[model samples]
Target: MSRKYKFRSQDDLYFISTATINWIDVFTRSLYKDIVVESLRFCQREKDLDIYAWCLMTNHLHMIIGTRGRKMEHTLRDMKQFTAKRILEALAEHPEESRHDWMLWMMERAGRRMPGNDIYQFWQHDNHPIAVFTPTVLLQKLHYIHQNPVVAGFVERPEDWLYSSAKNYYSSDLPLLDVLLIE
Candidate 1:
């Protein structure tokens, strides 16, 4: 809503955080998380997105991202839209989801209260995109992103988190997402 959060320049990389409506823990399951992973992969290949660093938490995703082709806002918008629909379907069909009805109900309610989605709103509208201007800010955001799971007590080490790019940074044999290293 303010000039500070707006994407002013296409050439500048931004540190972004997109969270779920009502802070729902939709990504507690790997199935839903994979949808985001695949979407990021698609964006990297098809949309010319440059993902420098990223981390996926239970409810929010943080990334230091730039793009060579598409507008940063558009790339994020498309990614969120596709992931929302696909993850909702996965929630509907997931046999082991204990909170299936509740999660969908919350998102639907949020949608009604929010501006965009007609029925259900998965990601909260504001991306909180902060332009990454300096090497210091980039490193700070990068550390914050990778250490999210560790700070949240989800894992003992940043690389222990299966869904984060820390694995890729830490020489993990198989990371879920491939990131362009800034270091």
Candidate 2:
């Protein structure tokens, strides 16, 4: 845990990115991606998480988030832990997951290299959090988050990415997860 990326202020919004261990394309499957979406929804509904924007890519996720009641760090920790466990379980139980064995091996190998992991590590330790202190920076991060899928050639337009808040921003359809619209 690097102090540099630690959430220091509870009220301030932060842009954070959490990657899969070894950058494995774990989220290429809809089951894994649904796990993340449901986890975020859970955090928002039960854990006082305030999500302004989010994007889920094949291997990583980015979000602009803050906290209202609980500490942001704690909420984030719970989200990551819960999601990791659920996603790993889903992978194990998924009958059609062709890369299940290879994915588990990679995660297990990465987990063994870490100190606290008991079996496997799903998400990388560092979130690479950047405090969104200014409106300019917030917009920049929002643009970056929405454009990730486009840059990766997953979509021709940012709003075409169903896993992001860009749809909520650009159209009337609700986002995959609830989002706090930024003004």
Candidate 3:
């Protein structure tokens, strides 16, 4: 991991993107996306996470996040671990998941290639965190996060994406997770 991507300052906010292992398009399903949303909500409520903005895409997620009580990196690690576990469990138990076996096999193969993981690897290890040091940089990242779905052709507008905080920014609709709107 590069020093630039590591969370260095405890109090500074960061823009981060976390991707699925092998960019597997794991979040094409709503169940997996909901797992991520709920896990982020749990982190915000109990793990001292301050979510400024977020967007979930087909294979990755972007967020501008800060921390209050816990270390940002540690809280994020817990969130990823918990979300991965839950999503894997859901994949195993989902009766209608046509790609369940394939997804598990891919994750298991990824886990074997990685040294730290015991069985499966859902999320890639690197968060690719960029420090949001200035208002200009913050707004740039905020736009980047919201524009992801548009760039991906998932929606015509950023706020139309239900899994993102873009709607919260416009007060268009309530988002899946509460966000601390940037001013």
Per-structure clash totals for the candidates: 0, 0, 0
Query: lDDT by residue for model 1 over 35-133, one digit each (tens)?
Result: 999999999999989888889999999998999979989999999999999998888788568998898889988888876557999998888889988
Give the best candidate by TM-score: 2
**lDDT winner:** 3
The 10 consecutive residues of candidate 2 with the worst lDDT sum are 174-183
The candidate, 1 or 2, that scores higher on TM-score is 2
lDDT of each: 0.87, 0.87, 0.88
**TM-score of predicted structure 2:** 0.91
Clash pairs, model 2 backbone: none
lDDT of 3 at 78: 94
lDDT of 2 at 107: 93
Each model's Cα RMSD? 3.7, 3.4, 3.5
Candidate 1 lowest-lDDT run of ten: 174-183
By TM-score, highest first, what's the ranking?
Answer: 2, 3, 1
For model 2, the stretches where C-alpha displacement exceeds 4 angstroms are: 172-183
The positional error of residue 39 in candidate 2, measured at the CA in angstroms, is 0.6
